[model samples]
Target: MTELFDADPQAAIAAYGTEAISDPLDMLSRLTAAAAHTMEAMGKRVNDIEAIRYENKQGGEQIRGEVKLYMQAMAQTGKFLDMLIKSGFEERKIKLDEQTAGMFVTAMQRVCARLELTPEQTVLVGTVVPEVLRGLEA
Candidate 1:
């Protein structure tokens, strides 16, 4: 492990470029942009899901199926987000992988608890989380 030091660190940092920082500002900017896009997509998906749920909430087989799909999608999205954070930390040599993952998981759990979702919305979120993660990793 490279020991952290203060004196004349520019040479050492230049050796690793931007990746050496705890949180590269440029990387964070890109991640933030991707996250914004994901949030927009998620909003649209939620709207569609709400429409479907409203249209077919008569306690039928389809409703059960949709609910199951929705839950699965949500879980998958959560996992992808975890992957994103993991990759980001790995790339940056951040030491708090566990803490970062926990923060993301906790945030997702809180969001899920607050929002009622449908299958479409869940799937969309799943897709978006991975995309955002990829952006961050890059």
Candidate 2:
């Protein structure tokens, strides 16, 4: 097996060959696999909760009923994703409102001045700040 170096991409490519280059679908497949594994683990947790519920019932103890909350969370997450898809949220180009964007830029400018950032560093921050702020929910 080839020993790959993450820090040195050229060396990693030389060692592992061009097959090391990843495509979107490859990444998506890996993500899907991880999600499936997570779901399986969550299923086991639900089973454990059911066992606890059963034991508490047999012993005439009060059930904590965490499984209901867990199921609700899962259902809510699914509904949220479904709504996002149906609403074409990802298809639209979303951006921060100008007022909020200006406020963020002004704050960052103050931060840059306080930190005494180099002119180039300040410029770099100015360039990326808008995109970064837009990525977050308001």
Candidate 3:
């Protein structure tokens, strides 16, 4: 149990004889253990961040799919409404000749005169008309 340090204040660390230690491997092993522990902690942190990123990606994809489905449903509803209107006109035995078409167009214009719609919305509604006719045929 020789004291590891000497009373001499000026004694360099090299002057401490290494013979007192039975094995230098113990110091190396401790150093390796500390490094391994630090590496393990860092690996776990990276794994957690990756998992969070994966979840976010999946959630974003799911939201996109839901939005697509909602748009399709809206389109389908619009088509159904258009078909109902078309069928009602057909039930009246009204042929869609140029004159009838003009009259109907004018009537619709008068009906929507008070309400304002953007050109895009009007185009969207117009696009659904053919789909509604197809649906009615089916």
Candidate 4:
């Protein structure tokens, strides 16, 4: 890059018959222009790399979320998620009262038995069920 910048100004000055132009000033101008171009290129490359990383990260998170959902469906925890939503927790961000919470536990226990899920299987399903139905909307 230095060699290119060093050669260009000399060639330009000779071609334009501008030796009368101060050699130092002309070279300085070319060097500054080359540095600006290099910085612009470097900035673009940095942006491209950042964009790729962001895209890859988003895709990875999405795939992981989907895989967890698949595991939940296999375990029948998808129904639990639906039951939770249908308990009138879908739109309003309201906390469940103690009575409602008890009912929920009872319902969950019934669902577990109905599905023939062992304690370990119930725990495994509880860990992976999608909190919200993101996949369904898609």
Candidate 5:
């Protein structure tokens, strides 16, 4: 790729104490990918918990048992997301932009699918944005 020299000087000064954002767009891309990777690593952890659910359940009770565990995780995720949003908005004066909102939609979809949650379990997990859910499911 060509060298990207165009960096917002103001942002660099604020965030990095530099004259310009050294890598600019490349830094954003790297950070985005790193965040995605971290989430993936965290996702694998749910499997370990679900495996315990699987072991403790009778064959026919597999769905019910795992759904319970799944719901607990989902509820915690929702609470954490809510807290993060509040913290960002209140403490940092950061509002959720459309791009971040769309990202949250995708993340909700991915987590739901990863847990293989049912409709009832979905309700227990909360966060039912009609348009976002519909679009994700579609």
Candidate 6:
């Protein structure tokens, strides 16, 4: 995973092109791509936390607490990204389609699995994603 850092607006705008900004589908594609990248990055972070525990046995308890905090942060961030993507579609008057939702759910599921979410966490995601998607569809 690329090192997490602040994105340069000029670089993004230039990479996306001025013409793409006016296109809602193109915008959605960009948002989806970003969401996927975040998920992958979160998974890598979770793996990194595990590696840290193995490398620093003296700080196992503190590392575990940090791991829990990281998991919660990632979960919330994932949900926010999900909502942001849905809102982007709704704001653009684009109907949420099965393929788009499926791809998003799959990506999120992978992240949740990587983070080893609790049953309640899993259920919250299972419930919320569909509700948001359904609202977008309606």
Which candidate achieves the best lDDT against the true structure? 6
Which 10-residue window of candidate 3 scores lowest in summed lDDT? Answer: 61-70
Off by over 4 Å in 3: 1-96
- The weakest ten consecutive residues by lDDT in model 5 span 1-10
Write down the RMSD of candidate 4 (Cα, Å): 29.5
lDDT of 3 by residue, 19-45 (tens): 675643444444445555555555455
lDDT of 3 at 101: 73
Q: All candidates' TM-scores?
A: 0.29, 0.29, 0.25, 0.23, 0.26, 0.29
lDDT of 1 by residue, 51-132 (tens): 4443345654344444555555566556555656766645554656767988997887678657867768867877888799
On residues 1-138, what C-alpha lDDT tens digit does candidate 2 reach at each position?
233465776887677565554554344445545555555666577777635454454677554455665565566556555555665544532433566767876887789999998889988887787777678856
Residues 1-138, candidate 5, lDDT per residue (tens digit)?
112224555654556544666844344445545555555555566565635433334545344444554555556555555555554433432344666877987897789889999999887666556655688987
Choose 3 or 4, whichever is better by TM-score.
3
Candidate 6 has what TM-score? 0.29
Cα lDDT listed for each candidate: 0.62, 0.62, 0.53, 0.54, 0.57, 0.66
Candidate 2 residues lying further than 4 Å off, grouped into runs, are: 1-51, 55-64, 94-138
Q: Write the per-residue lDDT of candidate 4 for residues 14-124, one digit (tens) a residue.
A: 565644456543344455455555555554555444232222544552323334433444344444444445655434333435667678678877888899997799987
Off by over 4 Å in 4: 1-96, 129-138
Q: Which one wins by TM-score: 1 or 3?
A: 1
List pairs with backbone clashes in candidate 3. none
Name the weakest run of 10 consecutive residues (lDDT summed) in model 1: 53-62
